[model samples]
Target: MDTNGMDRRQFIKVSAAATAAATAGVEGILAARQAPAFAQGTALGMLRWNDFVPASDELLKKTIIPEAEKALGAKITLETVNANDIQPRVTAAVQSKSGPDMIMTLNNWPQLYEESVVDVSDVAEELAKKQGGIYEQSRAVAQSGKKWLAVPWAIVGLTIAYRKSLFEEVGYSKFPETWEQYRDAGKKLKAKGFPIGQTLGHTFGDAPAFSYPYLWSWGGKEVEKDGKKVVLSSKETLESVKFMVAFWKEAHDEGGLAWDDSNNNRAFLSGTICATLNGASIYIESLRKPDQYKTAKGAQMRTDIAHAALPKGPAGQFAFHVPFSHMVMGYSKNQKAAKELLRYLGSKEVFDKWFVSQKGFAVGPTRDWEKHALWKEDAVMLPFKDAARLGRAPGYAGPAGKKAAEVLTKYIITDMYAKAVQGMSAEDAVKWAHGEIQKIYG
Candidate 1:
């Protein structure tokens, strides 16, 4: 499918057009229209992750929902849980055929539950056409063939947030640009009691965000481009695993094996770690309470924080920025109300408030948001503005479809490294993961 080349080219074209539109001062919210009316007492339920950006959740509860209800004439119920717990909830709901009418999903989950979810091509296509087209990474995960499986939501851009002063003290004036250099810097930092923090646990976010990109950068992938053959047991895969085992021992926080998405955020904020691959949440949280999260010198920690893309490997620099979407469950009787809610949420008039609340933690699904004025507010956030441009989905070198989603939900890639770090041989770990993937792809 040449997904990489196609997405890159399309993104460049869309981005340039969007930027030019912004330059011409064409930025504005979608024009107001008549609110869609529904039956009295029609209530729709939604499930989503407890946003890493608490302000967004607060805004949702305190403002957006009330406004949405007034506009849509449908009572809404919102439920949130840990990101790691969402998949289980989704599985249970789909099996029982009665649960939240709509669920917020991460990565390529739309592909994973394609048959169980209602097609929202009408909602998705309208939003994309109005919002300068959805980013390819977002589209790749939400769209399957000619149908849009879900409405593409915002993308959480992942970057390595580090303590700038700590790296400088270790004689690294700038963040390391290559994996080897990063490992060297991490080794020195760890000796100084500041290790790089990363998780290889069964997390839905940070674990695979690190694992998939790290694997791809070293030229390891789960399947071939045709998406039929398993190819994880390669020399490249083994070499990456071996390096990770040593890296974990010499440079990373050893306790990270038990950590989830929020652990590294807390570890970095607590000043126990120097760097970690995370969303802008860590930085945003520090900014929210400058006095609460201060350095030893009593300086605001946000001042000392900077973000960089993951280090480059032999293959190149890559990222797996988490793509989010809204899926309307097919089993729900409230499909009409759920689709209305999707349209309301996807509208810029509403989403802008949530986006601003994120403060660059989550960028829009479309290219136009890259032109948003928020990027100019903080230099540290600039890197994330274009992060999705380098994004590669799971099942890379193949379609990020059902099989890839299976591998992701099973944590195969993340566990491959976890196994190697926890005493398994690199070759054995790769072989084990390869066999697991073979079962799914076959």
Candidate 2:
């Protein structure tokens, strides 16, 4: 919390410059000069998710790849794909015992494919030491058993993005901080014809991200901390489902039942829903759109829509964050070159540049980077300042593993809530999901 040795004023200035750079389309701004070309002997192939943030991919192509090439004297062939597609590709690579030298993807894929991913303990430990140690969520995500299967990259923070003026119209000056308040607000807003939404469909982002946080907030967990037992059929879980049922009935439209990942973003931008839980992308994307949404008159859409922390439940407010990780494939012919490239990219100096380029859409795993300037100075980014520490990875109260990832990816939790809200008994829904989860854990 102490700025981690960053001078506050200096960081504020840096934040301003970063913002200016984003709007001005600054090219290679982080660089002071060019360097000698890479000696063409070693080649490393990498596969990673095509960044949702366009600037991130741009920086990778324009600056990061070039710099790493110059420093390591290696030719790095980078191929990026959609986040959803990374898993199948990684699985194919693992099955065939050959693929790109390194891969980066979302949420415990390293753990899912741990046997096929090289041990990156050296990279993990060394980077943690360099970056003031890894955050708890990072460690839980990237490590499997006793080995570090991957290096934790950045975490995408998930929180509630809502319309402030609408809340004010409902007599609340700020976003609700507790579930009781949220329900009340939802009812009032729905009465005013403004729906409150949490996706019940099979969305890559909205379904699990929001549901898991709500589950944890109500003290419901898929598995116990030991990670081998099913504990989802408890009172806590039923309570979470029942709460969701009530809220959905009072607030959301039937369309939310089938909504996918981009639906909420489109809904919010079009003023269809007044609130939803999502990453900073919802707000970041609004910055590029026209100021035509009438949610807040005379104010820009970016200014009217605000980010808020997850509302507290009976347990407390717990944020849900997905850990994106980087790993070297076990079958790669160029393991050494792969590790070297990760080391270069993971350094504070280089990562800081990339973080700035990302426009603060994500938080790195390091505790020290918590003091990064964008968090303190950017109004839209400030809500996520504590995400690295306060957040819990998916499958909380248990280690992230294949079972956990399976439960999450299959939309079990989302379906549980949806069934209950759509008039199925909460107990029956829990029983159905509990059985599905047990099959995975067994």
Candidate 3:
């Protein structure tokens, strides 16, 4: 899913240090002695996804933006669209050279647009030094070599949100810990009319979040460590695809093939599906409207929901979290204002408001957030606390760069599984995906 405080004396000391650091040449510093001067009607355009947790978006629009505008002395317009549609908007902006001055990007997209973005090394490094360092997973997608193509934002950790009662009713007292066990449990659940929910569509978030980790857990990868050699057509990949074909037939909601990232969330909330691999948004939504979402037995669905990490496979458990970052577009005329806005929004005080609104659907890019007291508020959210530590970026065993971004944007891995589930032979699906990836890598 796309999911803080300080003492007064300590805050003052930190603010003073930040002011000093701002004078030391950092381009974007929120704690500057005074907001930088700009044209009387300076304005910046920001494009972001319609966040899964609606409250987070609401927080941005109602609270954060006004505060930012007053603090930075610029008019800010926030535009949001579905996550799947973000890439096309980014592509359009890069091509037209005039669009939102700041664009929020997911996964390795910053890498795909590396040459079209301004280096925010000072902004990123400053954030890292102040907060605990950015997690390596977040850093991988935002940093190219030593340059910061984008400033790290947040990581939306995807987990298997399941019904505790449903798993127990299927004779599994605990959530299944391995793929075979999960499949076995899912088979029984489907027989009882509560199948698992998942998507294999060309979604930007949940589709890759599931597909990449599933591939890696079975020892399949799109490329080798050198990041050039295509090696996806392996015995392991074919085996995983073949297994998925049967698993889907036996255990999943068949309607998932056309579902987007939001579909599984809806399915789970409406009590139609027993479990889904998703961000904490599903559970968070239920919390937001406790009386609206209910279990089949007429109980609050929030009480029934619990989350587990993705089941382990032969190689090991893995995760492909959706890491988000803000890119200062190279074509932007409001570069100074946009960078200042990034600095403003990314500050701990401001980000905490948005983070609390998410209620654990999205975690901060830095390690400091894991230590936040909010994780202790809900046991169901604990699994996501350390999720970034276990995360593997796209193009596993290789750099998550432009080629990996191309493969991801193309939905190569996701289609590999979808094709098999739709009746293509597993070998053929694997071969098709391998060929597609080779076209990118070559």
Candidate that scores best on lDDT: 3
Q: What TM-score do all the candidates reach, one by one?
A: 0.91, 0.88, 0.92
Q: What is the TM-score (0 to 1) of candidate 3?
A: 0.92
Q: How far off is residue 11 in model 1, in Å?
A: 45
lDDT of 1 by residue, 297-364 (tens): 78899999999999999989899999999999999998977887888788877888999999999999
Q: Model 2 reaches what TM-score against the true structure?
A: 0.88
Instruction: List, residue by residue over 285-337, the lDDT tens digit for candidate 2.
Output: 87766565545456677877788888899988787687788989989887866
| After superposition, candidate 2 runs with Cα above 4 Å error | 1-40, 290-298
Which segments of candidate 3 are over 4 A away from where they belong? 1-21, 24-33
- Residue 56 lDDT in model 3? 85
Over all chains combined, what TM-score does candidate 1 have? 0.91
List candidate 1 stretches off by more than 4 Å.
Answer: 1-34
What C-alpha lDDT do the candidate models reach, one value each? 0.88, 0.79, 0.89
Better of 1 and 2 by lDDT: 1
C-alpha-based local distance difference test score of model 2: 0.79
- lDDT ranking from best candidate downward: 3, 1, 2
